[model samples]
Target chain A: MTEMLRVENLRVEIKEETILDGLNFSLEEGVHVLLGPNGTGKSTLLGTIMGLHKYKVSGKVYFYGEDITDLTPDQRFKKGIFLAYQLPPAVRGVRLKDILKKILNIDPKKDLPVEIYNYLKSLDLDETFLEREINYGFSGGERKKSEILQLLLAKPKLALLDEPDSGVDIDSLKLIGEALRKIAKESNLLIVTHNLKILDYVVPDSVIVLLDGKFVYKDGLEIIHQIEERGYDYVRRLVYAQNLS
Target chain B: MLKTYLKEIRERALKAKDKPAILGPDIDLEPYMRTIEETPIDDLEKLPDEIKENILYSGITPSENDKAGTYFQINHSVVYEKLQEIYKGKLEIMSIQEALEKYEWLENYYSRLIPPDTDKYTAWAEIKPTGGYFIRVFKGQKVEHPVQSCLYIKEGNISQNVHNIIIVEEGAEVFVTTGCLTHLKDQPGIHIGISEFYVKKGGKLYFTMIHNWSEEFHVRPRTAVLVEEGGVFINNYVTLKPVKSIQSYPTVYVRKGAIARLYSIIYGRKDSYIDLGGRLIFEEEDAKGEIVSRIIANDSSKIYSRSEIIGKAKGTKGFLDCRGILLSKSSQIVAVPILDAQHPESELSHEAAIGPINEEEIEYLTTRGFDKDEAMSTITRGFLSLEIPGLPKVAKEQINYAVAQLEKAGL
Candidate 1:
């Protein structure tokens, strides 16, 4: 099997405080989930991979056999790496239609392409919402829907989704899962989620449990089902037992 | 009597008092006044054809079959006018000289909003202006096409002062777009525009003014609008080129159930000092007002944005939004927004922010596909965008064209 992503001793620190310490993981072309308790550096790991300057990282991150540790967020984006942020910035005076136009590099005088309108229809969003300001006064579910919509348009090779189901309503979550389900067929998805309910709609091929910024278990989707049934405490016992050995 | 008013204003202009602190003490009024006296007005036949062709750029010049009226001014004089079929008998578009000689009703609105006694600029205009335009829309008639005007400077080492009066009678609506430009070779001249607008009860007036002058030009505009009950006044001002200096503080008065919306988008570059703002006075109950300013300072420019809203009656509401972006560290932007509420039930609010364009937003744009320059252009467009729901579609397209031109010119 070919390795899609390889992290060698990844360490992240933010403002003199260590968030992720010595995390090493490798993933192939498949759907994967990172499960951990609250404040266990799940988001930090994804942010480090996405090249956010908020954290200082010391590690080697290789994608498809090439080192991408020092690449910029935008640079990685051009190379087919996309992150659907949990909280997108509310940029005043920037409309959704305008942003989409810039992203797609369409002529300003032309109407939006039919493909995007069709994608929006599947999400049940009004086409007129394109004229409204980006993320301004948007509800939680609406924000999530917008991120997923961007993902569908971006068409990345490696997708890093940070808490895509946390604040989303059940209906939005189902819709998001359906969209990601289609995306996972072509992209290697690393979903950082706490809610295991989305797994019912879009099942992952592999599940990795993170403990204190370290991956403790590497197994198939059955491990995720086990963790869901027995809760995180069972994983904690296994994590501590493995660390002691 | 007019001579006495002129003498008073000339004396005052010599030693203008209480000038804003931002203007500093280095301002010398002697050069402008001297230029006004030394320069001679040119004959119409001797002028270049560009003076008339400039009106074509304003998109207001009437075709052979068109009924929309137009007034073109060259060196402070109205050189051409076309009040066609629809506006022939009912509407009146005349030079200030013609109006003073032909109509007695002009006295009721002339200088009523911005009197010659209001300031030195108005006073000087009263004393020395060559010519101007006087427009009166009949009561209850909606003017579908915009009345266009152009003020072009053809002479060097001179000053041009023109007074413009616009009156929308009761229940009437009119749109006016003015272009103020000077020749590229103008040698250190001054342009002072004094305009007064009156929107009668239930009337509406939409006005747009675009300024493009040479590097050696100094511009000073004095304008005021008075809206009666249930009236509306919308003003849009855009200046996207370099000039020596510009100072304007236009004002509007709102009556019961009336509204005043002021929008200004300015680009200051190449050592230009631009101080632009608006003042809204809520003089009656249930009045509303909003002021929005977008200032972009590049090179060594300095920009000062001012907004003052005064609520004197109950149930009045006002808001001010000021945002500035600086492209260079040497450039400066100062925002001063003041709110005065005398009545307990009146309310006013303001929001202001000045900074360089955000690196994160630029990076976010790049994540999609845009390079650095494209990202910056996109962000600049977003910063200057305004939500003008009631403005005409042509005005919006003109704004987009102006912004694109500015961007292309490396502003």
Candidate 2:
């Protein structure tokens, strides 16, 4: 199988502090989860992979075997890579329907009858919400659903969701998991979350443990059970043992 | 007020130039200037009813400075002759003096829409020729197309003070588009253009103004619309480029059951300075007003929008919304919305928002395959959408065109 996304020796230093240190990872066309503590650079790795271009990054990022370490977020987007931020900005006076229409160029009178209705129904959002400004005054769960809605609308090849289940409610979280599961069947999914409650709904094909900016272990879903039982002490011990060996 | 304003004009005229031992009468015609200033007031009593009605319908505000009678002579004589030639048969366009001389009683009907001495420029504008436009739409008159006026600065070093008065009688509809433009470069100039609109009950009047001037020019445009009961007035004022400084706030005074909507968008770039906003005053029941403004500033440019809504009458509803988008670090945008209500039963609301474009949102869009510029442009195209209820198809198309260009330019 071909690698969809590959990160080699990725070192990220933000404000003089190295957050991602010589990280190495790759994912095929399926679901992958980066699970770790809050400060383990899970989000940073996603940012670097998504071409955020803020931090000073050293090393290589390859999308489908092509070097994209220097590609901008926009270029990556055109190449079918997408990121769902944990905290999205509120764009006032811009309606959600208008944005969706502009981005997708969907003819609402003819084509949107079923597609839009099903999309909103899947997220349990009412039609009135479509006319309101984008994420303005939206609840935490609503913002997550909005992100999901964009995902469904844009339909990129790779989706890097930074803590997609962080602030979402249980019901919406389930919808998000289901949506992720549905989307991942056709596209690659890399979800970054500190807690694994979201995994209860949509299990990951592989789990990677990130510790102190480095990947300590890469295994199946059962590794998450190990973290649930042992904690960071076990991961740190493995990192120390590997460094000495 | 006119006397005080004229005294100041005289002082400014004295400082204009000094040719030692001037012998050519200094090109000052105080008597003719005084005739231009006071003749309208004097003719109000002597003119026939028909002529008086014509003058009052002309909508000219007489000179404020009773003293620089000489200043009006030095500045207005040439302006009057040129205006007479430009607007000979199609419509009646004149200065306050000529309107007063020709139709004094008519000039007396509705004069002071914007009070003089609100500022120096306004005060000076009140006295300087009061460049007035007299356009009359007969009852049941349907103008096939809109009429346009261009207040152009033809000379390199010149100050233009043009006042316009438009009246569309009952059962008539008229569309007027006026613009302020200049060709001079690196030269200091002042332009004060004021227009008064009176739409009789059941009359429809649409006014559009496009203002673009150079950096060395100080442009002050004060326009007012008085909509009677059952009248409808739509004013679309756009400022594409104001080089140096601009202070223009077109306002509307709607009576009972009238609808007034003003859509203004101002863009400030480079070192431009813009202090622009608008006002809506509702004085009767069932009257409504909406003011929407969008301002963008880049480089070291500064834009300030002050929109005011005064709801004093019952059943009156007014909404003032201002949005500011600042692009550069040095650029500044200050939007202040003030609402004053005397009637508790009236509905009044004001909202103001200022912030940079969200980087995360842009990142999301960019990751979706747009570049940084494309992301901003996409967001900006979204920003220009305002609630333009009952907008004409052509106006909507023009606004769409402007948005497309802005998006293409990456905001």
lDDT for each residue of candidate 1 in B1-411, tens digit (9 for 90 to 100) = 444443555565445332332342234433555322223223333345675454344333435243357677767556677676776655678777787667666666666677565555566676567667888888998887777777777676667878888888999988888888875554887787888898999998888888877778888888899999999999988888888889888989999999999999888988898888799999999999899999999999999999999999999999999999999988999999999999999999999999989876776666566666877887788778776878777667666666667666774
lDDT of 2 by residue, B246-300 (tens): 7777778889988888887676777888877778889888889888887777789
Cα deviation of B308, candidate 2, in Å: 3.1
TM-score of 1: 0.88
How high is the lDDT of residue A113 in model 2? 40
How many backbone clashes are present in model 2? 15
* Candidate 1 DockQ, CA atoms: 0.43
The regions of model 1 sitting more than 4 angstroms off are A9-22, A53-58, A211-217, A225-245, B1-26, B33-67, B183-186
Fraction of native A-B contacts kept, per candidate: 0.41, 0.57
Clash-forming residue pairs, model 1: none
> For model 1, what is the alpha-carbon lDDT of residue B396?
75
Q: After superposition, how far is residue B358 of candidate 2 from its true place, in Å?
A: 3.9
Per-residue lDDT of model 2, residues A79-195, tens digit only: 887788787777655677755764575653433446777888898988888887888898999888888887787778888899999877778888998888777777788998876
